[model samples]
Target: MSVLRIDTSIQGPRSASSALADVAEAEWSAVRPTTTFVRRHLGAEPLPADAWAAAITGGPLPEEQRTPAQRDAIALARTLADEMRHADAAILALPLYNWGVSQHAKTWIDLTIAGAEKGERLLEGKPAIVLTTRGGGYGPGTPREGWDHNTAFLRRIVADVWGAELTLIERELTLARVNPAMEALLETAELMRKAAHEAASHAGRAAASSAR
Candidate 1:
């Protein structure tokens, strides 16, 4: 089996979202020992911010008439889209950044959409686990209850647009341990972390079973 794993964490080893993804991948690997993973690190290697626009503009032009940038952008978009289209399962680590989706993840998502056929569900009927972490709590009754603008957008794309059987693992207050101001919330943060990891593990095993 082939699984597409996309990590968009600039924090490297310290990333909470990536840590959850590792848990999921480990569980999946345990179940499917011979599975192959196609990896993409958008945070480590960001797509060109202008690539999506170039690809969009180049779509109607003949190959010979396209500029070098446009040609490259189109090719890159196709590669990203193909990765999702062909994956048997997927794991995505896309943390919330500045109250919204990070530019790195957004660019990757846009390019993938640009490359696919219009309205085509690239991951149709496939299992996809999305691990998203937040530095602050935004749940009901919290001061920032309505401030989160990341998770819902992801749900729309992964489940509604791509048509994946989505399993979302979310952890909030990720900065509690590091931010002195959030000391009182440390316990809550730890609990959230554990829950997210547990969810990821369960999702991974489920994904493996479903794929099989």
Candidate 2:
């Protein structure tokens, strides 16, 4: 089986989202030792800024009539889509940026969608897990309830647009230990982080089982 893992944390090894993703991937590897793994580190290699616009406007045009930029854009989109199409499962690690979606993640989604034909959902029914880390709490009843602007947008693209069977693993209060302003919540944050890792492990095993 093949699994595609996409990491969008600019923090690299220090990112909570990526740490959880590592747990998930490790669990999957333990269960399926021979599974093919594909990794895309968007933070380290972001998509070209103009690629999305070019792909959206040029994809429907005949190849012969496409401009060079359009050609390259469409080609890139196709490459990303092909990875998803071939994967038996996927893990996306995304850290909330300023309470919103990461620009790199958004670009990836837009480009992937642009590559698909009309009415096509290339990743339909594919098992996909999303690991998200937020600096603060935003659950209901919290002071910042409804403040999270990323999750809904991600769900729309991952589930509604691509038709992936989605599972979300969220770790909030991620800045508690690092940011002095959140020092009081350090204990809680540690607990949440632990829970998130445990959840990721379970999700990974489930993904492997489903793929098998």
Backbone clash numbers for all candidates listed: 0, 0
- lDDT for 87 (candidate 2): 87
Q: How far is each candidate from the true structure, as Cα RMSD in Å? A: 0.7, 1.2
Model 1 lDDT per residue over 1-212, tens place: 89999999999999999999999999999999999999999989988999999999999999999999999999999999999988998999999999999999999999999999999999999999999999999999999998999999999999999999999989999999899999999998999988998999999999998994
The whole-model lDDT of each prediction reads: 0.95, 0.89
TM-score of candidate 2 to 2 decimals: 0.96
Each prediction's TM-score versus the true structure: 0.99, 0.96
| Tens-digit lDDT track of model 2 for 48-75 | 9899999988977999999999999999
Name the lDDT value of residue 104 in candidate 2: 92
Candidate 2, residue 37: the lDDT equals 88
Model 1 scores worst on lDDT over the 10 consecutive residues at 203-212
